[model samples]
Target: MAGIAILLDLWRKNQSFNAGLYSARTYQSTQFFSASAAATAATFAAGSSFASRALFGSQVAYSDAGAALPEDYISNIQSASERVFKNHALQYSTKQYDVQLKPLFSAFELRTFALTSLRSFLMYYLPLLEPRVNMEDDDDSLEDNQEDRHVDLVVPFKKSVIQIIRESTVVTTRRILERIAVHYVSQRMAWKILKDVPQSAARKAGRQMPTLVYIYCVSRTTFRGHMLGVAASWIVQVGIDLYRFFTSGFKTLQEDDDEKQVGVLAQRVSVAAVRCISSLIFASIGAGIGATLIRPSRGQWIGCAVGDLAGPVIVAVIADKYFHVTL
Candidate 1:
């Protein structure tokens, strides 16, 4: 009975302790709800006020880059418009842009004009002053006979001589032009190109691109184009020499009837062949010397002419002395 009484007393104490803890927790929760409600009410009151409304409305005000032009932009546009108006006024106004020019003629000019007018007048009128010549009964016959003689005697010789002259003239002109191009282009430019063109291909592709271009212009070598042109010119000279020799020799043979005397045709062909080669060599030497001493194109032409004239004499002399042949 005494142990049961002590147990009952301990149970009552535990129950009383639990009730006090529950009351304390409920009081804390009530205080927290009151404080939160007061804070919420204060926030609502502030939000409804004029200053808060103004602040909130001002936060996201209307704006864009196109809404207003910059001060500098407006000023620049105004300035440009003024400049255009000023330029236009200056350009079109008679007071600003009026210009006049009058030609002044000298005494010499007037005399020249008068002389030209007189000459033109004379040319236009003077031809009608002459009376027409009367035709004879045998005039047609005489004209026909003259035409026939011209066709037979003059035409063939003239045609042959003219053809030879034309060929020589064309060849000579081509050579002169080639020499001039070489002197102007190669000597003036090729050496500089050689210096600038780099040996390394990698660098050529990079910094020295113009050097590569120059090297290409050089025919992939040192003034190779000029050398090739000279060689081509020499070959052309040989062909020209052959034509001149054959044509002149044939004409001479026909005039003198010397074919029978010269014996073998082979010897004549050999002599002519040797003559052309020897002449070309002599011409090259002479051109080199003349070019070194004088203006390149003029010197080349002069030297070529001298060598050309002397070449035949040299051949003739050689034939007379060494070969005992008159070629």
Candidate 2:
């Protein structure tokens, strides 16, 4: 019995010790699990906060932080292009109008104008020296045809004289206006304005192009070259019209009638515009045909001059004959 009791005591002591150890372990494990859970929650919260902040920062960077919209980009491009065009135009004008650096008149211009006037005078006078054509048309091949002879020789003579005077007056007026322009504009600009259309056309004809394209190029070149002369002629015509309008007492009576005045001005402008366009078209055609036929320079010059002179007459004749629309 003693031995049995001793064994029981040892067994009970071992069991109590084991039970204490197990309880301690269980408490430690529970504490560790709690700490782990807290650490994991804190880490999760920090990660979530960081992810949300990143998303918000990215949105701000895209929306309001130095980011350009499509419209802003296009506006920038347009502004840059406009600046470039403005600069180019300024540079070109500067080069063309460097008046202080160059003389207004040169010997070449004077000689050329003199030659032109002399040639024009001869063109008119030489026809008089030739045998009087029985027919009015110079192209009439049958000079021997007595049936087509003019009965009134005095009328034809008067007509010739009037034409010569008219031509001389035109040349003088153009020269005077050209010199006046030289006073305000640069020599280069003035020269360009008065440039020979035929010479320019001849030069441009070197390039091979379709017939229609060639004609168009010639016409465009001629128009540009003759712009100054056309403008001067239009100005003269407008001045005359205005003078007549004022002299007729319309200005005094209709002083308050701004609409009437504007209408008259517009009508005059339209007439001038039509005439100018017709003259240019005819001149361009002449230049092209002349350049193609005769020696480029001489042919172009003669053709252009003839076309410039005859264009208005032809238009007038056509209007009177076919359209009954007097210009």
RMSD of each: 31.2, 24.3
Clashing pairs in 2: none
For 169-211, candidate 2 gives per-residue lDDT tens digits of: 4545566666676788768866666666666666767776666
Task: List candidate 1 segments past 4 Å from native.
Answer: 1-263
Model 1: lDDT equals: 0.46
Error at 267, model 1, angstroms: 2.5
| Alpha-carbon RMSD, candidate 2 | 24.3
Model 1 agreement with the true structure over 1-327: per-residue lDDT tens digits: 223223433543465455566654443443333333334333443445456445543221211122233556545555665676677788887532211211222212556455544554454345445554445559887787567444243454455554444444444544454445445664534343323212222233344345336334322332322343334445555555567566767777574445542443446555555665556555555544443345544554455556655766788898899988775
How does each model score on TM-score? 0.27, 0.42
Query: Candidate 2, residue 12: CA error in Å?
Result: 81
Q: What Cα-based lDDT does every candidate model obtain?
A: 0.46, 0.59
